[model samples]
Target: MNSGEVIDVTRDAIVTFLKVGGPMLVVALLVGVAISLLQALTQIQEQTLVFVPKILALAAAALFAMPFMGDAMASYMTRIAERIAGG
Candidate 1:
């Protein structure tokens, strides 16, 4: 592939990755921030307090978003495969 094709492929891959992971990452970040704020306000300096909520939130987000993520990745892979076959 040429440089332009390579760049397009790279961009598609990155976009696919972000699309797949963004929801869970955002949920985890929000949960972490909220937990941090609560900890600060309550002086509950327990590590698990912060970790557990974030983990749970991320897990829930992952579960909820799994179908969409799978579809996006599958579409991306199909596009990649088609490009390879065409080229």
Candidate 2:
């Protein structure tokens, strides 16, 4: 593949990665922020308090998003295969 093809592939890979991972990251960020705010308001100040909730939120998000993520990755792989076969 040429430089342009390489760039295109790289860009697609990044987008695919974002699509697959964005939901969990967003969930984690939101959960962390909410936990931080709660802690600030209640004066809890417990450093370990955030881990369980964040992990649970991320797990739920991943479970909910799994089908969409799978479809996106499958389509990306299909595109890659088509490109390879075309060349």
Predictions: Cα RMSD each: 0.9, 0.7
- For candidate 1, the clash count comes to 0
For candidate 2, give the lDDT of residue 35. 99
- Per-candidate TM equals 0.94, 0.96
Superposing every Cα of model 2 onto the true structure, what RMSD results? 0.7
Tens digits of per-residue lDDT, candidate 2, 1-87, equal 899999999999999999998888899999999999999999998999999999999988988999999999999999999999999
Q: For model 2, name the residue pairs that clash.
A: none
Q: Supply candidate 2's per-residue lDDT for 6.
A: 97
Q: Weakest 10 consecutive residues, lDDT, candidate 1? A: 47-56
15 in model 1: Cα distance from truth in Å? 0.6
lDDT by residue (60-84, candidate 1, tens digit) is 8888999999999999999999998
